[model samples]
Target: MRSLITHLAALTPEQLSDLIAARPEALLPPEPATMAELAERLNAAPLIDVALLGLSRPELQIAEALAALGDGCDRAELAAALGVASDDADLDAALVRLGEVAVAWPDGDRLRTVPLGHVWPCPLGLGAPLSALLTEQRADDLRRIARRLGVPAGTQKAVTVRNLSAWLADGANVRKVSTTAPADTQELLHQLAWEGPYLDEPTYRYGRRTGPAQWAVEHGLIHVAAHWGAPLQMPCEVALALRGPDYRLPFDPAPPSAPTRPVDGESVERESASAAATALAGMVNLLEECGRTPVAPLKTGGVGVRELRRLAKTIGDSADHIRLWLELAMATGLLAPTEAGLLPTEEYDTWCDQQPAEQLTELLAGWLSSEGAPLHQPAGTGQPVPALVHTADGAAMPLLRAAVLRVTAGLPPGAAAADAQAVTTLARWRNPMLLDHLDDANGLVEGVWREAQLVGAVAHGAVTDLGRALATDQPEQLATVLDRLLPPAEETVLLQADLTAVVVGTPSRTLTVLLDAAADRETRGGASTWRFTPSSIRRALDAGSSETELLTALRDRAAGARVPQPLEYLISDTARRHGAILVRPVACCLRSDDPVLLKEILHARSLSTLGLALLAPTVVASTAPIAETLTALRNAGYAPVGEHPDGTVAVERPTRQRAVPLPRASDVVTAPLPLPGPYDPGALDELLAELFEDADESHPLSGYLIPTQPGPLATSEPADLARRLLRAAARRTSRR
Candidate 1:
């Protein structure tokens, strides 16, 4: 087979430019002046890795087997190596794709690739060739194999090795020698041939006694390879012959199709919308919690498992469920990291103002491209991968996620496959390079499924309409679908005598805020339940709600039913005792307009921390600082406000802090495989135009663009430009 450079040299200037345009400029040779340099750069390790990303499963399989076969192999030989038919259309297509990517080219009837021996050691788990292993074998063993093969056993070690290598090269000769082995030994040889062409010593107990391994070794069928990952290795030629006419292995050229069951489309929509609403509620709850008190991250820079569990308990949800919401919060910029911990960002307020459908649409967009893998755990480790830790830098999680969504989108509406493995298999087939880490693929696939379900992109294991919109990046379509599927919001609640209230559907923003102020949410889902408690009523009072206003609001939102007596009584009673005991910040001295109010504070035991001492009938003095006094009063259920030196109210605004936004989805390149330059179609043409321009003769770009050396044409003469143009034109005409 001819070298890749020789094949490249035959292409016209336009064809070569098109090929160069297919790759990024960064992957090409720097200032290449000849076809040889271009070939070298294209076949370089990094570029080859990138080119392989465009191949399908069968294409990649053929490439791997061809590289393993060494030198070059005919179509039949290549098919035999992969245990497939030579005339298979998939095989033919795979060869064409290899040529298109410049990973391999056709030479007569054989296919040749770049020298990949260094790139993939032992491709397809096949061992080193018999010729390469000859150097490591014992001299006596070599001579004995030569004598058994009816080849002259030369006295010198090198001569005997040379003679055996020639014999092993011929498939007919290798099969003839295999006839001496017993039937059991032949069976073992065939098994080794298809299954990695090697056997572990411990599994076979080869050197112990008269076994099949021993019989094969004595007949020159298998040999010891101590430096390999396995102990014993069968010669490449012998393995191919043992496979026989219809060489077959476990390789699957086509992707596995998952078995699916049908479901009702309406039911799927209902469930998915419900899940999406639940997910939205969970995120809102998380933001409110973070705003109230910034959560401290672990020493390792992520939320600890214990803290997440505690939050789960507080929110009445499982830890795993909460983890998904937390990740969504991070992904959408609702929450950001701070020096203190993780806090709700300013974006959270705006996000909360949007409708449920709009809110969910934004979340789905972020999730589709999010690098967060909350449900993915390291192998053998009980801990899950954490979010907001920036640990996913350079990882292909976003690419894998899109691939999984693509597979799900292919299923018929309201149809669900049996399990995630089918989706994983299909996804792996489409983007072979993205899921190259075989050990981590399963965990990532499972995590994508869990996240998609939690985000309402999937329901009953089938993709929803909103999910299809998300996958296609149609935001308007996503919003329309969600609005149609999501249940309408209710403006009222069912009040019970037991001081509990229930909303039959999602509550309107106005009613939701009202309930949050006066009641504690006990549970939330499709429907939400709230309990009216003394503490909850007190919270409403503390937030500046008057007793009359609270009562009127409750009455207006009671679903045309009268407010329960027990709930009304609880609220009235709590308001009555709310400010019976008032404490004020005693800045050196405490003064009040009423002498009786001062008297009440002086006698209260809880006010002892204020260190109050009477100075006059309307005044008291304290040794504690003003700030400390104010906190103590507030903690003791007292209404306290600081005063200025002029006796006016002191109003201070709290500082709003924000962290740097997380890496956006757009920032992550979709091609997870190592690709050269961000390809631009015009770069190659621009480069070529500059090469023959009547500009600076010593331009560096000319060296980068021209595949042929610019010898005498280096001058900026008119004839030089015309001549080069004519030459390029001739090359194009010849190709046509």
Candidate 2:
């Protein structure tokens, strides 16, 4: 790059003109590009020529894929890999883009990338390595598909046609699961635009069953239900998130792992992965609790203090542990507030059902993409930390998180740079004139690192596989890299004599949730322990589980352990005691045709002790009250009668509920949240174009004499005129 400019600087006027004629694009960059300034982007993907930026993301991918396949690779191969029709005009257009200025060229019947393809290990600012993207398995698949498609030998587009035919015919068989916000969810999000910065639970009414708020809750579109009876309205903050400019649900791309580390790398890598798995497993366990019994939100909004404490006790961890894990779940849109209590959203449930590795990847992405600093505040600080939005200083946390990730993304794999140095270097590169509210770079980086670790994006002082994908903001590739490292999920558990069930690897969310309901987690790791307690078994029975469901869940998750007798006894006993207490509210009570039933109710445990002074063999006068006695009667299994003053049997019914009418269209606000400005490439593009345009298109300047502007006595000297016109023409020739 230095020499290209220096050589131009030294070229005599004659030589300059002649050199420009021989290789015009070299002197004048080909038109329409953003890549010249791509170096400034945080990811710093492999550098490419300015011209290459002219293509869209898809076009760039096509161009680069062709380059990877070598000169022998043809349009058929590229089109197949890219999943585009070989003869499609769009494909032709992309090919033409590569050919401009010899970045690629038509070689006989096949098209090949030239300087652009040859410039880097891969081209067009693609961070993916060729080895990863075009694996032997993939190439072999292409070949096999070609044979299946009956492509003729030596066919010009043989490889591509085969790949394309195969992908077209069988690709649908490959199921894809990704987080999505459906129409119902989107409508609920739309309501948040004008309704508020936050919905007031006590006063605000649910608009409709179909509205965004309800849909968001049902779908986990907003992690917390904010439900004031349950599933709270979408928060102003979550609404803002849903309104991101790029409306597609955020996803990390298929991963492309970085270069392997040298020395102690194997041990360090495993340790890092282990740490990530551990952290993620903790959050998942907490999430399992929410699924079991969602906690109600405080009247003020957010999880209540008492409820948080209860969760801590139940999880068998300290309150601090509860707060950290709970907030992290909320921050990641996996937990939300509800009238019933803070619980996992529908989105969380759907996500939880995915494979273990995918579950971790999704959480890591949410952790990185979150705009708030749930973990940034000092412990015991009076100020309540924002769940997942702007930081303490009001600067967008997403931007700060991105900055830190960028620094790590640029480091060599396994290299551990000082956090302060990374912060300082980032600050120097930051655009101070535009953004505001971020002054504590060191603090921001440190806090972000801590949160990153807890969310499993980083481990052992380095970015994990998921972290690198997240740091690069290439969510589409997370699966690619992570799949290689993901251990198979544990489908069952080991039951011991002590009623302890152990999981060997990444535990299935389904199994975990079921086990947590029927058992208590005693320890977590490769082989997590969950002891089946009597209370835990009762919890399962109380949750409306049939005995078979409980037995099946236990048997399936128990790997091959013989069902312990005590465990079976606990389940059976809990089932017996499960519905003994059935209470109902009514205006009146205390009569029954059956004398034995009334007597039984009066003597029932705690109930009779409370106040069932019998007035008659078939009737009881309660010093307690009708409602209290009614509850006691049910618990005692008496099913006593409630009678009106007229001696008629009484019945209770609830009022019918209806959806609230939505506000007038004029009243509902719909607006997008502001986002940080992306870097501009227009200026760099113009500079490259201006420096390279030819003085004239035809006739080598070395052979032909220069001509003055037509019909002018002398518009200017030939040399000066040539230079000025060259500059002017470039501005016009360069496409944006």
TM-score of each predicted structure versus truth: 0.62, 0.46
Instruction: List model 1 lDDT by residue over 1-736, tens digit each.
Output: 2377667666655555445545443222343444555566666554576567556677777777776676566778777666668887877787876776677877778778976666567676666666667767788888887877788878888998788877876777767767777898877887887785776654444434246887777656687764433477777666766667455533566776777888888887888888888888888887777776677888877788877877777777778877778777887888888887888887877777677777887787667546567777667877655544533432456556766776788887667866778778777786676677545787778878888888878888788887777666565787788888665567889999999999976777788889988899988888899999877787677667878999899999997757988988888888876654333444666666667877887887987977889888877787788777656666666555456677665543334555556544333222233222223322222222221334354644445433343222112222232244345546765898
Q: For model 2, what is the error of residue 154's alpha carbon versus the real structure, in angstroms, after optimal superposition? A: 74
Stretches of model 1 off by over 4 angstroms after superposition: 1-42, 50-57, 69-119, 125-174, 177-238, 256-261, 314-316, 331-334, 346-372, 377-396, 410-414, 420-441, 466-584, 587-645, 650-655, 662-736
lDDT of 2 by residue, 108-197 (tens): 567644334344443322222222222322344345434543433233344554444333223221111002455654554555533432
CA lDDT, every prediction? 0.68, 0.48
**Model 1 misses residue 203 by how many Å?**
27
Please list the residue runs of candidate 2 whose C-alpha ends up more than 4 Å from where it truly belongs after superposition. Answer: 1-267, 285-333, 336-343, 378-389, 392-396, 409-415, 418-437, 473-477, 484-488, 524-526, 544-549, 573-609, 613-736
Q: Pick by lDDT: which candidate is best?
A: 1
Global local distance difference test of model 2? 0.48
The best candidate in terms of TM-score:
1
Superposed on all Cα atoms, the candidates' RMSDs to the truth, in angstroms, are 11.0, 29.2
